[model samples]
Target: MQGHGYAQPLKRPPDTAVLIFLRVLFVVIGFTCIGFASWAMMLRLAIVTRKSLDWGLFVAVLAADVLSIVLLGSEPGDEIHTAGGYFGISLLLGTLVAATAYYLAADIRHFQRLRDAYRAQQPMAMPYGYAGPASPYTATTVPSSPAAPRSPLGPHTPPPMTHTPPPQPPVPAPPQRPAPARIDQVRAELDELSDYLRKHDGHHEGNYEGGR
Candidate 1:
């Protein structure tokens, strides 16, 4: 997960206060995830938002853990069994699935945020297909920035500039980047939208740091 340095960390993580008061509930849910989701979510928060926390994966796991409670709720003769039986297995699988999803989205978000920053700073610094170090993860399949509840204008590559012969360049110069005010407006709009999509979209939680 390279390139997540730009934005300020979130101020408050989701779903901590409620869980704090419901401490007794932890004993039941604790064994369900086997601590996998908590570990994964903790890692995300620790690595991601220095200022705030991120426990999205843990929440997803908690949702799955309720299934265990449903099993315990069953009466002696009820159709629901004393043990979770086959359904109990879903708890581990659910947490693992959540962990997998969190990693994938978080990693992609990290890469794209940095990629956008890099392209903005030095649009032509590296050739498109230079074949740098291989990444186990690739954005090729995504075909675009990570999806979100609400889509925003993208960090598209800068427009191409016209080239003239080396001895005499064209009279007209290439277009300049948008003004600072324009960049700020865009980031502001993006931040606003990203707040809404923080849970669903992986890459867009922070503010833009690089400037012209």
Candidate 2:
């Protein structure tokens, strides 16, 4: 299974040596809880393999550690119930759980880093035209041009252009009536009176006509 292209082993981190020490410590503690000895080993293997089942086993081991601490402090006999011994065992179990949790978290982070690096190293797929595969088997047909539209009468001829004259402005009509006849009669009367005065002035002096 490890031979698959995508199934390369995770690179060991700088803190792997510390994790190994913690794993050995956990195995020693597992001896105290014989029921959980197998489970503790399974949990370590799951961590190494980066399996989803590891979380369930980790929880089970944590619960087992808690129970072991409780049993140590609450044993039936007075010999096992010493305050100092109970406190020491409690401290050791707590440390084991803490170390296991730290290692699991660090391993998960390292796995994520490896996955990210692998994805970054992979070359992106080229688009359709840049360096695509040749298609020699496919037919290479040239597209045909569209035919010209035909007229119903005879050989196709463009419609004749007819010239349309622009509209002319309307002409103004003459005045409806001529000047009034009374104006012409008044002018002729004024000219006759001036002629009579000029003819009478020569016949009589001005002072003689006024005395008569």
Candidate 3:
């Protein structure tokens, strides 16, 4: 006989704090530096990992870096700097701070959305009647066979049937009689006799006297 036992729960991988810290360091450096190398690395990381927040951060950082460079370049030769230069420096710092804050807010929002989606996808609890991981001690339920479908009529009643008679063949009509030609022949003979009398009436009377 097979021995009964309980199934062990599956183990999950541990979240590494060091790896996360290194990733954050790299992102911070990329944001601070204005070089193409850092930008390329950050862009690659963002794209490969499908991190929208990273992309947003890269854009914000790039904009701020470019603005700062432009502002610094606009300053006149390295004197103690004028009021305009001081204002420009302040503006550049403000831009950097604003950009960082904007991207950070975006990252937080993105994180929230991801977290919400993950929670939505996770099963809250086992389905109402679903049997979870079965244990040897758990009782197996034998589902009752569904009752056989019942007829609307009584169980012993016979189904009603309609009787239809076979169709009969149609009767044929009687043949019609042909018209007579004898009347036309008699009329023709009478016409010919009248024609002969009209042409030779005197000859006929003379021949009769001679015969008397």
Candidate 4:
């Protein structure tokens, strides 16, 4: 019992004084700051694969961690004497935070580009929420952009092209032509008119002489 008591007093407990913020950072940044790729994997957005993770950013993050350790004061009353050091820390943290946004946007655009290229190759593929393929007149030949807006007709159909019509001169109506009478009908009408005129000729002459 004496030996056990003496050993107990000499035993130093493991240091558990690490801050909660550091613990969270350890979980997020991982052991060697290679968690960016791992983060991509966990989120299922593939901005950086294991093979594609940027070593440049890795070095930068590693350097920032070192600088943060050297520049930051651990004690409650610790202070930085130089304004340059404060500016450096601020700039470093801001860049790191902005990196997250950059990766997010890159992942989304990469997904869009790959999907459009695939659909362009497969022409017949009509995926959900798919608009029609891009047009030839667009700046890009490949349907890389989200396809043109879908019309009521269907997603496969190209959007309607809007343009002004060319002006045209008004067309004048055609002139009406009189109908020709048959030769026999015309001869009969003329003979009838002549006989009627001969019958009324003597009466007409007598009225003219009386008037005179």
Candidate 5:
């Protein structure tokens, strides 16, 4: 007799070390993010100290490659031969490196901006001996004098100065009444006590029950 119902397709078990490798991937990603932040910080330091060895970026890139090995594993798989998994893995890895470089380029630009701002704040020294382009990567020249202002239209007059109006004092707030006057209700009972104290001219009995 034919089967009564269609059999369910068996689910493929996850690859061994799948969870372990994925955990490593997450850890590496976290490490990479921290390393990127550190590199950015170090780049700022390099700009200030005028030194080389951006070890942060170097270490982060190296970690990213090692991380891929965790994903790709050491041995060739059956799928590697049939489905071009090897080529796919290779391409994927190349893209990851390129992406990291592109992302770091922005970080580098930010560091450059910070450096320019710091340089601008400091007094400039004249070219004692001609220092060439700061570095090969630096596309633009750092001017000996501060950058000259450019008018959108050639040679425009400066706009007239405007005074900032004095800040108005905040309006005096009206007195706020207590939300529900339970205290006020009790105040009527205390009115006699207030009158007694006034008559006594601030003299008070030391015979109260509470301890000193």
Candidate 6:
């Protein structure tokens, strides 16, 4: 009861202080990780694809991360007093930011180009909104030739067939022979009779000796 009564209000940090701290921390961490990832990606691309542009851009991004870290860690009065330090920081950070945007934009452009290429390679029979592989089931929208009839209602209809073709003659079956006399013949006949009775569309006789 005494502790609860005497409990003091929590001393929360100022909003500006928290915001500055978070902003610096997030930017520093984000740039560092992204820069390193870009560097590794560039290395892979260079080794595999032998793309000089990617390698160059990757180096630029990495330099940016280093510049940001240095600038963030500098003493309070160092940036103002040293002209060389100020110029170097400004150039490196600015270049890093610009290069990052440029490469990202380039990547988007390349992706769109690849998508367009893929679309071109697809079969023309496929409709615009189709989601599966090209097949007869896909809706086709190609223009028809002039020889093709527009519609039955608009164009002249074909003359109705005055005479219908005669129905096909019944197929002739080979003549069957009479069953041969054998020991299994009697059993087979009994089995056939039982099958017929089971399948017959008639009321079955009750197996009772007498009916009410």
lDDT string for model 6 (66-141, tens) is 6655654574663455654566466555654555455445544544555566666665886778788568776797
What do the candidate models score in CA lDDT, each in turn? Answer: 0.52, 0.64, 0.60, 0.53, 0.52, 0.56
**Model 4 Cα lDDT, one tens digit per residue, 104-189:** 45544554555566556554758899878678687464556666555897867776788879999999999976556666688899
Query: In terms of lDDT, which candidate is strongest?
Result: 2
Alpha-carbon shift of residue 125 in model 2 (angstroms): 2.2
Q: lDDT by residue for model 2 over 59-134, one digit each (tens)?
A: 7656655666566657666565577557646655664555456555755565567667766766797887796656
Candidate 3 wrongly placed segments (more than 4 Å): 1-64, 125-212
Off by over 4 Å in 5: 1-67, 77-79, 82-84, 87-92, 124-212
| Higher-ranked by TM-score: 1 or 5 | 1
- lDDT string for model 1 (15-99, tens) is 4454333333433343355633334443543355332334554455556655644554554554545446446545555555555
Report the number of the highest-TM-score candidate. 3
Clashing pairs in 4: none
Per model, state how many residue pairs clash: 1, 0, 0, 0, 0, 0
Error of 5 at 79 (Å): 10
Indicate the worst ten consecutive residues by lDDT in candidate 5: 36-45
Model 2 residue runs over 4 Å out of place are 1-79, 127-212
RMSD of each: 50.3, 12.9, 15.7, 25.6, 39.5, 32.4
Q: Which of candidates 1 and 2 is the stronger one according to lDDT?
A: 2
Misplaced by over 4 Å in model 1 are 1-38, 49-54, 62-85, 123-212
Q: Can you give the TM-score per candidate against the true fold? A: 0.28, 0.31, 0.36, 0.31, 0.23, 0.34
Predicted structure 2, TM vs. truth: 0.31
Q: What TM-score should be assigned to candidate 5?
A: 0.23
Which is the better candidate, 4 or 6, if ranked by TM-score?
6
